[model samples]
Target: MPSPVGHALGGAIAAVLIAPRGTPTGSGSRLMALRARLSHPLVRLGALAGCLPDADFLWGRHNMETHSVGAALAAALVAGLALRSRRAALVTGLAWLTHVAFDWLGSDDTPPLGVMALWPFDDRFVFAHAYLFEAISRRYWLPNFVTHNAWAVTSEVLMLAPILAVLVWWRQRGAGPRV
Candidate 1:
């Protein structure tokens, strides 16, 4: 599956696309606008959600319950209650789902072969077989491990960077009233 970096990027992209725009009235520097967007509570929560599925790794369950839609819903509900905002909950849930989406599009070299994305509904694992992102290696002792993972990260950046650039451009260009 894709590395945490890719998952985090996916989450950020989801936030950029789904979270309501909060650009302040009047004009501002592109960097400041981007900063404001990134620092929004919903966006930060979305980014956190993106990497949360991997927390299962701490318990030796990498792609099981935590990677499921059920878990995403649960998370969303909890976030909604805590934040008192349905949109925040939705953004968080979608950001979490981006983790599953990235895993589905990535190569998985380990056993079990795919993510249990439909866990509560169906215990079956699912994989896209698209191989858009390279599988990340956990074997840190291997000599080539660093280089292999570096290439994987580079590929992820290549794929995600353009989307981020476009988001920044769109936000900046649309920050002011259009008339």
Candidate 2:
């Protein structure tokens, strides 16, 4: 499956698009302001939520029930009830959905082919093999970090960084914090 870069970038995109944003303290560049804004607790929470569904891998389960739409709905419902804000639930849910969408659109050359996106409802593994994303390197951390994974992640960054830059810049220029 696609690695953390795609997932994290997806979360960052969600944060930029949905989270309340304002100018940051200090005479920092817009990029710096973006970094600061992304550090906000709510933005970070959204970013974290993007990768949270992968936690099912902890028990040797990669993409079964947790990768389903049901899981996203359950997350949104729980987050809405716990956070007492529909906006929070929406951001959290969108962040998670971004991950699933990326995974669904990614190229998965590994066995089992794709994620069980409709698990518990439809047990089929779904894959687009669109190559919009790069597959993770199944090597040791250091080696992978310097090689296939690095290139893959760089591709993700190259694809996303400009969009993120434009989004942040537009948000800063157009208005104050949005709901």
RMSD of 2: 3.1
lDDT of 1 by residue, 1-179 (tens): 88878888888877777665546444387677777777767667878899999999899988999999999999889988998988878878999999988898899998787899998999889988999899998899999899999999999989987886677566545542231
Instruction: Score candidate 1 by TM-score against the native.
Output: 0.90
**Candidate 1, superposed: residue stretches over 4 Å from native:** 25-27, 172-179
Taking the tens digit of each residue's C-alpha lDDT, what string does model 2 give over 1-179?
56776687687777677766557567388668777776766667677777888898798877777777778778878887898977778777887888778888877766687678776688887877777888776656554556888888888889877877777777666554577
Q: Rate the local accuracy (lDDT) of all candidates.
A: 0.82, 0.75
Question: Model 1, residue 27: displacement in angstroms?
Answer: 6.6
Candidate 1: 10-residue stretch with minimal lDDT: 170-179
Q: Model 1's lDDT to the true fold? A: 0.82
Best by TM-score: 1
Q: Which pairs of residues have clashing backbones in candidate 1?
A: none
Total clashes, candidate 2?
Answer: 0
lDDT winner: 1
